[model samples]
Structures are given as structure tokens and as C-alpha cells.
Target: MNKDFHYFGTYSAAILAGHSHEDALRIARSAFFVDLCTQPVLNSVGAPIEAATTMLAMEMADARSDIISQQDVTRTWASFHFLPYDLYSERKGCGKKYMQKYRLICKPNGDLLVDTVTQVKGKSLEATGLAMHVLADTWAHQNFAGTPSRVINDTNYHFFEILPDGSERRISLRPNPASPDDLIKGLFTGTMRQGKETSVMNLGHGRAGHLPDYSCMRYRYLPAWADYEEVIKDNPSDFMHAYCQMIYAMKYLKGEGGTFEKATYDTETVAPYKEKIEAIFEKRQTDDSEDWKAFGESLSGQEIPDFDTPDYLEEYHKAPEDKKDDTPMGRFILAALAQKSMVTNRVYKSGNILLGISGDYKDWGTKGIRAYLKLAKEVRKGGVI
Candidate 1:
């Protein structure tokens, strides 16, 4: 959900849940890192390519449509950005191929979300961040699949923004990649509809654009998967759910709470700031990063630093080989690999091979053997998957 929620909002949630400033920043940094930890960054840092959590624009352009490339895309995007609610959703009168993509549609309070959050219990701060990032996106990315599929991820619905005074403003959009989303005038930008069933335009929420990322937006449209039924996206409510759930998750991770269950939120912790937090969400703006940052700083009395990609990443690159795993980026890398492996395994076990089959990363014969071994360590120690 961009830096607003991924970085600043996450830090605020962590602090509200009783984490120290340092710990909150570490968790928020790892959560935001899911978007920036691309293959190019991995290459510069000499990190294992398999630990790559996100793909850069160039990487997306270079990716071929082969099964191997598809597997890589599904693994990263599905596990990290769009955690599926169910893999065995009923899809009658559809071919087996269509059902695979349909079943990957994301929804909030999914079983997978519970498993992911619980998987990071007693794990590193980096692991908590990764899980939080995934948790928050479940609200923002609902109804979109992680993989590329025109029928599955395409958004051709008529868009409207729900105004504060109970009015509906029909929003205009241009399918121009170069133009930014004009949030002030309520104009948006999205990917052009593609004819190819597997075109990249249909990946995740591209066709829907940044509307999902903005916290202030509440809109209505006919979802492709809803069979002409209208669906209202109440961002204030959904984003609030995400924030509260994150607090509950962090408390659980820190051993201050009970079991991590679906549909549960830590409302008591956020009760004091409910009005202020809701105000920020209801403020119509393209970028709410500044607002969230200000809120977090006010709560902590400590300045929330801007997101710097090289902070922890370069430290991992410069550290001695034997001591790298102790570094922030190294720890994050291990967590990423393990999380990816676990999610991939779950998808396969649930009878869906759309993300490809999962296997033991601990296989010593693998090309990136060190990454695999460390992945095994995180899995075994954390009891994740």
C-alpha cells in the first residue's frame, strides 16, 4: 500500500502495540522493503537472487512468458503482495485453467493471512515486517490476483468515489502509464486493457491503479468476478481493519497477546487515536505518507526517517562473509526466502500449481546454496511451514 501504510502506518501500529521506537522502525523498514527488494538491488549487494522479494520495472519488461518466469512472478507477488483467501473456491462451468487463476483472488481475513502472521511468531523483526506488509495489502489488494490474467485481474468497471456527504462522484481515468494519478481532481490512471490473456497489465491491481493504495478512497464498481453485483470498497473501514490487525499481529509476535485469529483486531490499543487515525484515512490525497509520518512522530516523539533503500542493504553487502547473516538485510533475505518457500508449498498442497510446485530450498545442490541453507535455518528455527 505504498510508504504511507507500509512504512509510516506500520510504524504507528507497532508503537501503539507497545514496541519501542527502534523495534517499530525495524519492523516497518522490513515491511516497506517488500516493494524495494528487487533483483537489481540483490545483484549489487551480491545477495542471492532467489531471495528477491520484488521485481523492478526492467525486470518485469525482461521477464519471458515461460513457465519458469511465471513461477517466479507468482511466488513473489502472491506470497508477499496478494495472499489468496482460498485456493479451492467454487468456480462452476469453468475450465481447470480458469479456475486456477480465479482461486488466487485476494480477500481480507483469509486463512493464509493467519498462517503468515503466525509463521513469524518468535522470529526476527525483519520477519514481522514482512508478515505485516503482506497483512496490510490483503485489504488494499482485495479482489486482485497476484498473477497476470486478463479475465482475473482486469478492471473495466465504471468507477465512482464515495464523497463524505454521501454523494457519488464518477471518476475519470486515462490509460496512460506516463501520467500520474491526479488525486486532487479525482482523475486516475491505470494500465490499458490488453488483448493477451496473460498480459502484464492484468497483474495485481495495475488495471485498477493506485486507488487501492490511497487510504482516503471509498468507491464502488462492478467487480469482474462478482458477476455484475456491485461492490463498494470502503477504504476507511478496510484500511482501519488492516491497521488494527497489524497491531494485534505485532502484539502476538512480541508474545503480548493470544492466538492470531481471523476477523480479530486490536481496537483497544488504537482506541485513543481513533479519531485522528480516521481523519487521516478520510483526508482525500494522493500521498498520505507525510500525514502518517507526522502522526507516527507525534506518537513516538521521535522523527521517523525517510525510507532509504541502502541503509540496511549496503551494511549486509559490506559486512564480513561470516557475519552477514547477523546484518539487517541478511536477516531480511533469509526471512524472504523462507516465506516464499512456505507460501509456494501451501499453494501446491492446496491443489493449485498456478504458482508452480514448492520444493526443499535446503537442497545443497541448488545454485544459490548459501541462501537455501539459511532459508532452511529460518524455517527450522521459526517452525514456519
Candidate 2:
């Protein structure tokens, strides 16, 4: 697979510059490494120091992560709940529609030590730190392919509850949640949340466009696991102004006969129409599509096409009271509970008592090895060319 150009060059140089693998890791943990996430800069001679730094970091991470037993890391990576697409997009980050939960791997041992994979939208520093952790974990695990001595973060932490009766209770918390969905939601909620932007829909709507804009924005939010508020801190009025201008300009583009060269208006200019702008995006994919068409055809074949609206709209629209059972959230909760029980059962079977628990739990050898292989295979042959 192709590697990131900038990351390749810098990492090669670091190795040649008498830096050990450990030193390279430490360097990556620095603030300077975080800066490489943006565009590259040049030194006095224009050697592309910034590019080199990124290249080095990537190489370092990849090379170290490669130390694993060379099983199919790519395949396992693909099965991850995250990275919904083959390549994680930068232009369109995570938007309102999609959210992900992540695992935190500890360094040196590549142990999945931490349950809370903290992520802050709009907070570059925090995101950078998380990225560094991910890279470090990847490297350590790849390098050390043997069975992990212990599961990462298998110890218990203290949890507390504040009751309405004005008393507090301390409870022991397991390292990871019992249910997969709950674990996923817990990791998601613990690591990410609604920020000043308040809603993903708002981020998708932008100032003017709908579905496409929302989709684009979603790409950005997804990869970074960002908070909209943090991104807008530097330009509080950016979304508002951008939305108004896009709408005004769109009118002219769509033959509305509006002036294309109007003077810039303040954020207040779009306030009245913001709600409408948001609506357009929410319904972007409402139009007929192949996916809907295929489903409609299938429903017809099954003799279940009795509906006022087309079969295409049936899935999107809500069913009647008797038809509607579990909301998406409810289904998610049930799944999470089931996963928790399974994991708990596995713990019991392992006979390795959890740190907080009085009993024992079993050792699930590095199943992550397969996951990593899957993830690596996702890297295209040409490497995002």
C-alpha cells in the first residue's frame, strides 16, 4: 500500500538521523508533530520540513505497527465500527448523521488500557493528543505480536452517583462496559458530545446549502470526531454569513434573477431564513435513489406494496403505531445490553478476576490482531492517490 508522501520522507530522515524507534515516538508526542496535521511549510532552502515531519510521523507509526505477526491487519481494521468508508475523508469530516466510538491503546505494551477514547470536536490540541495515542498504540501492537500479558484497562475505576435524596454513592466500575452498544455509546458519549453548535443537523445545514453541504461537513466531523463549537471559536459568525451568502448567490445561480455581486451582509442577514436553509439539507436524499428503488422492487415482489406513498418512501416514513416497535435508539440499547452480557460472560469464563470485581476473567488473546489487519487492507494500493 502507498504511504502518505510527507510522512514517508520525514520518518525516513528521522531513522537516518540516529533516532531510535523510541525517540521517534517521543518526538511524535511533541507539539511539533501536531502542527504537521495542517499544510506543510518549508525551511530556508524549501526542503519541506513540515511535509517531512508528517511523512516521518506516518512512517514511524506504520513501521512500528507493522511489527505485528504480519497477519491481515488490513482486514481486521475494516471490521471496526468506525471508518464506515474505505478511506476516511478529510474534506467532509463527520457530520450530524454519523457518530463513532473508539478504543484507546496504551503505549509500549500496545495494551488497550483505556476505555474512554477522549475526543473533542473543534479542539485541535485534544484531537492531536488522541491521534498521537492512536498512532502510538498502533505502533506498539504491530511491533509486539505476541499474546498480550493482559487486556488493556482491565482494572476497575470508581463511579459515584448523586441521588435526589442528597446523598452520594460510590460504586466500582468495570474497565469496559458489558454490552457492545452500551460500550460504544459510553465511549462515544465519554469521548465526544454536543458542543456549542448543539446539533449535527446544524453543522450539516451550514449557512445556505442542505444535504450536500451537510454530507461534506459530515465527512469532516466523522474523521476528526470534532465539536462544531471548537471549530467556530475563531469565527463566531462564519456559519451565519456563509449560509446567507450561499443562499443569495444560489438564487442567482438557479436563475432567481438576484444580484450576484451584492455587498456582504452581516450574520443577521440570514437569521430569518436559517431554519429553511437547515431544512433543505435534512431532506437532501429524500429524492428517489437506486437503494430505495431496489427496496421498493423487493417489497412489491413480496406482495407488501399496499401504501399511499410509493414503496420508496415507506422506509423513510414512520410506520403506524402497531407497526412501530423499537426506535433506533431502543434497538441500539438492546444490542448494547446483549453485548455487555456476552462480554461479562466471557470475563467469567476467563477466570481472570477483574480489578474491581472479586471474581476472575479469561484472557482473550489479541483478537485485535485480526482487526488491525482488516484496517490495513483498507489502505488503497496507491495510497489515497
Candidate 3:
């Protein structure tokens, strides 16, 4: 989902879950930063540099150093939860089936999400926020896969546009077999990216772009090779469902419940928060704004300190070494790496790939945990990883 769910909606859920306003804001910020923490840059002397601020600066930077592995941890966490199409399905010659497993709303794979969240509940608020990101996407990205597949996502050359009044009219989509550059262009121009026959970095939502993540968007498509079409209506139920799940998960995390019992969508449990949620959406729409910082501040009922500024770093530098994990940045980094081993081994590579099983899966988790701890220690020393 968009920041509407990731930042604002998550904050609301934390509040509803009985967290203090300050704790709720931190959880929301961590949720949003999961997407923002992709870049890992190196300084002039080849020292790894952390993103001082959580704001987007152009496109995400590539992983370059051991220090950059922190970014990889976050990226990997995101891939498991959001870009989950990497796991192969059991069906033969049906890569699309693998992709469909993560589409929770209209598919049978939501149990995987619920189980994953249940295992990770009470680990930490940061971890819970990470799981929430994945849970929210199961609804917003119901039909799309995390991996790039031409047959599953590629649409025909036909074009359609949704007018201001919610009516659609035919418009020009970009030429067929759209290149990566063409796909980028189509994102800005509101034109569809026609799919290519071959697979070549045509990853998730490249054909549809970010429309699937927009809460206000409704789209329909007929795959060039498919017999039927898929229609996605603009609905808020997905957001409502996410909010309800967050509440339920929080209860389990708080030890109030032993297990997470999935609630029916739009049930009475979430009905009370519907008006508040609608008001948040209405204010966002009326303002036509995507300023997450301002929106988060409004939800937090306080002004947040800018972590990118030097003053924040000065305070960070002065904090006691043993108390580092209690600091905001330290807590975020620790939580990012905390569950890497479990997710990679148990969730991503649990004999789920296209190929058959190989070695002991527990070994994979062991190796991953070792690597994360080594790199995290290096980052704490001097950000040299």
C-alpha cells in the first residue's frame, strides 16, 4: 500500500492498539522507513555511509559494502513481505501460481502471512511494523506477484484512463514490449507499459507501475494471452482490513492473546475506527498531499525531530555505548537485522523455490544470523561495514 497505509494508517493502528502517541509514531515511522531504507552509500574514502535522513533521495542506491548489508537486511525483509513472488509455487510450469500465493484477499495464501506474523509477534514493535507492511500489501497487491513475469503481468496494447468522475475512457498506452526506460516514462504519463514476451528485469508492477499501491485507484486489465480479465475496484475495505489485523496482531504481541485469530473483513471490531480512518483519507484527498512527514506529525500530535540534522547525530554520538540499542536509530537497525535469519531460511527458502530442496534449512538460518551479527557490530564501531 501507499504511505496512506504504511505511515498514517499504521500510526492509527498503533494508537488503537493502546500504545502511547510517541510509541505509536515510532512504529509508524519504522514501517514507512522499511521502504525508504534501501540505499547504502559509501563516502569518499570508501567508508560506508548511512542515510542520515529517512527521506527518499532519487532512486534507491545499490548495496556496495558490508555496512550496506543493513540495507540488504531491510531490503530482504521487504522482499519477503512485499516482493514475495521470489518463492516458487508447487505447481509445475506455472510460475504465475507462485506469484498468486502472496495475493491474500482473493487467494488461499493468506494463512502464510498470518502464520508469519504470529511467529514474529512480540519480538519488537519494529518487527511488528515490518510484518504489517507485508500484511497490508496482501490486499493492495492482490493479483500481482513480487517477481517480474511477462505472462502474469503483461497487458495488451489497449489503453484506458479513469476520468475525474470515476469513468474510464480509452487513451494511448505506450508501444508494445515496453523497455525499462519506457516503463519509467509511462509511470509519469499515466500510460500503461505494454509487456514483452520475454523475461528481462520486468519485475513486480513494472507493467502496472505504482497504480496497484494507490488507495484511490481502480484498474482493470486483460492479459494479452489470457481468456479473462481482472478488475480492481477502488475500495477502502483493504485498508480497514489491514487496520483490524494490526489491532489483532498488537493484542497478541501484548500477551493479551496467545495466538492471532484472523478477523472477518470490515467486522465490528474495526467499525469504530472507520470514521477516524475516513477522516484521515478525506483530509489527504482534500489536500492532494503526499507529505508523509507532515501527515505523521499530525497523527503524532507533536513535531518530530529531524534525524538528518547534525544535532540529532551529536546526541547519538554522546549516548552511552551500552545504551546504543535503546536509541532510535540503533533500535531501528537492530530490529531490521533481528529477523533476517528466520525470514530468509524458514519463509523464503523453505523448499519453496522452483528447484527441489537442498541442504538443512536450519543451517541457512544459522549462517544468516552469523553474518548479520558480524556486520551489525562493524556498523556500530564506525559505520565501516
What TM-score do all the candidates reach, one by one?
0.95, 0.16, 0.67
Q: What is the C-alpha lDDT of each candidate?
A: 0.86, 0.24, 0.49
Model 2 scores worst on lDDT over the 10 consecutive residues at: 78-87
Scored by lDDT, model 2 comes in at 0.24
| TM-score sort, best first | 1, 3, 2
Where does candidate 3 have its weakest 10-residue lDDT segment? 41-50
Best candidate, lDDT:
1
On lDDT, who's better, 2 or 3? Answer: 3
lDDT of 1 at 315: 90
Which candidate, 1 or 3, would have the higher lDDT against the true structure? 1
What stretches of model 3 exceed 4 Å from their correct place? 41-109, 158-166, 171-201, 223-227, 263-269, 279-323, 338-340, 347-350, 354-370, 374-385
Report the error of model 2 at residue 212, Å.
Answer: 16
Q: Write the per-residue lDDT of candidate 1 for residues 1-385, one digit (tens) a residue.
A: 7888899999999999899999999999999999889988898989888888888867876788898888788888999999999987886799888888888999998888888988778779999999999999999999899998888877665878898889888866678878888777778888878888787777888888888998888888766777777789999899999999999989999997678889989999899999999999998887789999999999999999987887777799899998888888887887898788778878888888878776555442345446677776656665653
| Residue-level lDDT tens digits of model 3 in 1-385 | 6565777667767766777777776677667666655433212212123321121323322323242433333334334444343343344454544434332112213555666577555456766776667667666665554433455555554545454467775533433444322222223222234343223223344465555555544456654223465454443555556667777776667676666665533245557546755554434231212443454455557664433423323444566866655655455555555434334444434444321122333243334334355334634454332
Model 2 per-residue lDDT tens digits across residues 340-363: 222223322333122011112124
Off by over 4 Å in 2: 1-236, 256-385
